[model samples]
Target: MERLVQTIVQKRLLPLVLVALVFIAAKIIFALITIVAADEAYYWVWGENLALSYFDHPPLNAWLIGLTSIFFDNNVFAMRLPTFLTFAGTLYVYWLFACRLFPKAPERAFLLTTIGFLASPTLFAWTSIVYNDHLLIFLSLAATYAFADYFSAYSTDERTSTKPLYAGALLLGLAALSKYNAAFLGVSIAALVIAHPRLRTLLLRPHIFVAGLLCVLMLTPVLLWNIQHDFASFELHLVDRYDRPLFTSFKADTFIRYLASTFIYFGPVLMIPLVAIFFRQRDLDQFGNMTIWIARLMIAFTFVTFTALSTRGAVHWYWGAIAYALMLPFLPILLKNMWLYGVHIVLGLTFVVYATVNYSYAPVELLLGGQSSEVARVYGWPEAGELAVQLERKHGPIYLATTGYPTAAQLAHTLDRTDIYDLDPRPSHFSFVERKAIAPGADAVILHDQFGNLEGTAARFERFSKIETFVYTAHGVDINKFEFYLGEGFISDGDQ
Candidate 1:
């Protein structure tokens, strides 16, 4: 630990403390103010049943949120608290990895890497929200560190411990469970093992085999869930998200949109040059480490896969964000020129702009135009829930039903009712819950509007007793108009 204290005191301690404080402060502010986002709301409902896996994502994020719900109110903060803490862990792992990779000015190097992560528009912005990306980032960092240690060993006698190596495999499994993107880590692991002669010795060691077994064990839940659900989640990720099937979904217009979003999200000026630097130094063998090799594989995998998918539709920029930070330690070798600090400022400003758009309206709407309404989804959830409560007093514990999963989730959190669910036509997680809760002649209060598909929801009800539209407003602005349908005599299978 010759370098550990210097890195900790000079680079890690004060900034990390500030990071913690700011993180906590932001958590408090956002948690208290922002309503649940549509995806968050969707995952929030996933916590209600505590399944092995969800319709869209793996179960880790939902499990974390579900655990936190026991300790805090079922609000944004409670659901997102785990994400914030997980980011702190990622920051630490980044520092540790940097310290090992850059021995000369490990402190400064670590600080720069930390800034790289802290200034990421997608990573930083996501820490305040409950996204599976949050969990995957931390786990990805840890697994990256372990792989670097194992492969970058100074000698055969200095090989990495068996425990940490095995732990990396386990973490990767958990990461895959967090989001399917972690599967790309397999590319990194394979490249490391196959590229290096020493690492291939793992073929003889039972340690790697045990780790592989553990990884597959971790996937048991997702596999079982998919089997039960007609492999719906697997098919969704593989076929729907990744499989483009030649020229069908391919479009240059979509590819251009992907480039723009990726550039903006990764930092227009900051990341482009830095990525150049990393690849340049990597080419020259200036900073030869297994960590770089690991990150290189990851970046290549995500870039190639996402770029290919971009031909189909707009790409998700954050797909590479996790691997992006892992490679930042190599930037110092390439970035000795002036204006480096200026680039840092630019990255920070970019983060601020993204935060403003994500949380506020007027400015973002002006810039993003039609897409500005992304912020509107968070509105009216709590208010809609409140209104439902007041109406429940008159309706006498009426069943909660909403046209969209977003409304249903927010309402479920508000009413503390798992009975609250979406009424979409296709069988969803909501379909399973809503069916058991419904009884013949039972009164169901439906919050419906133009936003989501209500498809065949009306036919499930016999007749409507009361129908009215209410404008949901907040902060002196109207968010949306919702038509509340008090439908009595629900027609369940028992009626048939």
Candidate 2:
């Protein structure tokens, strides 16, 4: 036993293994304890109605959820299992990236990168739930690793191979598919390559064309899906992204929230190193120095874009998580300084402790978001579904729906039913849910927020005579009330 233990210590496997195990355990515990979050449940609904892609984003998340739901039963743990494993994959790939980027102290590099990556409060907290960031982190690491190897080969005096460059492009394409935020990586890489004289020749390579074709092919499903849907998804995701109206009406509160949260999301343990690396620019023609430039470019683009966007809309800090991840491989450089290394270890462990304890308790979620707020998106929803089911049985053949997507999705999920639709005042994916609408002479139940505009919802179904209205109270909350209506010569279309 002593001999085996010594071998393990000598190999420096103990710390990396411990970090993986502890983080994996914390994620599993969180998934098991917490109810399904709103966005997660909302995505769960997307899985129920399988499509090539979804209206809100790409289809990788739905694909992952569908695969996970098959083996583990459609519950919180099952839904989140894929994301947890994705996080695990991210750590392993990042370690490889670290080893390649910094060979002198590979073990120390892996350990600190793990601390900087896994111990990040936002990144760690997100592992417990299903988010596209899981896919983003995984694919982004793959891209980073492949890009470094490719860059190394490109920078060498004798060019040995172009395989890594092709592989990097494929990974980057998939990264964009995972989440749109990764598109900025291309921007960063372009800026650095254009500035570096030796690397500028890459822009003229036929290999770049081959890789670009592969990316286009990988992204075909998303494009085709949009083509069939009149490119609504394209309009919503890509066009609307930059379509913020009236920048003159900027909100200080939005900018304040974004600025305050940006530092925390980048992982507090990494603050000093990220700052140090960003300000320092080395010879890009030199091997291994490219990642620092990439890291700086990523950080700069992410903070600036998100901060500008936040002025016109709400931006969550985790939106920049993948950008922060590009900097992790460079963190091992900080390990040479003993005091900073200690700070990284201390902060990493402290975050792990807090996050581990917090995920298991409902009360502590307040620090992240209140149980009812957007961040917590998990509360009283099952209860809402139970009430809907009870009411549905009373009104036989009645169409059941709500004005909002989340409420409609929760009801559909818990009832183990489908076509439980949402009444969107405008076009949305919920409108495409089976192309469903109330038939003529049908009595229907509509759920809406209690404090919300009832007349606004009732106006959508004006053809139906209002029969009864009552609140659906659950878990000591009087929100999500229901109103009964009887249709008069109902048409297939009114307001989508």
Candidate 3:
């Protein structure tokens, strides 16, 4: 018993366990204090319906959350459980893969895995939201690991393992189903096979073909769903967003912002080593050829995707998360030089301080400072939802309109009503007004100050009593103010 205990301690299992505990504790703490962001709430709605696809993302993540919500209820903890568990699972898998990659340096492998977990800002952000990114990232990493192990096993002996190859294919298929970005894995793997003479066996293997078939089979549901829905998912993702011109100055800013955000979110300490490893040509030979290929592919894909989609949208949290994770094992190799390791430690500590100061459990007012109104504009819908409910009871079946869909969706969910409408003339990003315009009967309308032209329509209607106004503040700034107006000749305030 003493020997076993000693062995476990010496193996550093306790520290890893502590790190995991800290990770979960932080997530739970954040979950309690933080309201669901609009994106999270929207995705929760997607989970409720359990469709094959959504307007924004794949269905696997929603399905997972929806299943959990059945047991845990539609609350923060329930919504975040899938994300939290996926992150934790990814950490474990990273360790497993790291151990396989570095059989001689067990401690170093463990450290690198931990650093990877810490350096992944994308993972941290998505883990807090009920989004598909976490699932996709996990599946992508799994495929990478399986592919590495399978190729390594094949290289050692003539016998090929069907399990790893099949599993890798299945994971890659699921990843593709999660997001179109998974296609890059195939590109990366092909590059690896072409680069390494030892890996040429993979090209000749029949199991690779079998794996491809399995991947296609796994993704059949998405294809069928697209067919049934007139390919709305693809159209929305591919065509609808392309209305903007292809060339834009925003491309440079988008690329730079993504790079900075990724570093900030994942702690800089962990990223420095990864970046150092990525740029060092000499260190590339230390790991399997697969790592080099995966890293290069990820970088190329990020650059290409950013350049192409620069006019459409900025790089989002899950966009390149897996690529970051794939580069984890190589960080230690980069840290082999004392100067590189020293710089990494300083940057890592700086990030720790930044995250700590930014997220300390301070009062909401203190956190908002003077920009409270701006913060409110961005995240004020929840407060608006509360106000909307109060107005609904006072005004009776009120017709609500907003410039955005997120506000409308949140208001509808909170009020347990869907009569809310979008006041915007066209279907803008968050156009909930489209629904409200067609609502039956006379309806009261709510408008934000930012809806410049839409507010003019309210003037043409007869204004009755004004509902109470609520001011939303964020970072001590007022981004938007909400005012409620009843239709012309409706009951006055004194009618009650």
Best-matching candidate per lDDT = 1
Q: Worst 10-residue stretch by lDDT in candidate 2? A: 368-377
Candidate 1 lDDT tens digits, 235-275: 76667664467457767886888878878776654555446
lDDT of every predicted structure (CA atoms): 0.69, 0.68, 0.61
Model 2 bad stretches (over 4 Å): 1-4, 7-21, 238-247, 281-287, 335-361, 365-372, 375-377, 449-455, 463-496
> TM-scores, in order shown?
0.85, 0.85, 0.78
Over 134-201, each residue of candidate 2 has an lDDT whose tens digit, in order, gives 88878877876777677767877436587877787788888777777878887776686678776778
Q: In model 3, where is the ten-residue run with the lowest total lDDT?
A: 425-434
Off by more than 4 A, model 1: 1-33, 154-160, 241-246, 277-288, 313-315, 334-340, 353-371, 392-397, 432-437, 440-443, 459-466, 474-476, 487-496
How many steric overlaps does candidate 1 have? 0
Query: What is the alpha-carbon lDDT of model 3 when measured against the actual structure?
Result: 0.61
Indicate the residue-level lDDT of 405 in model 2. Answer: 73
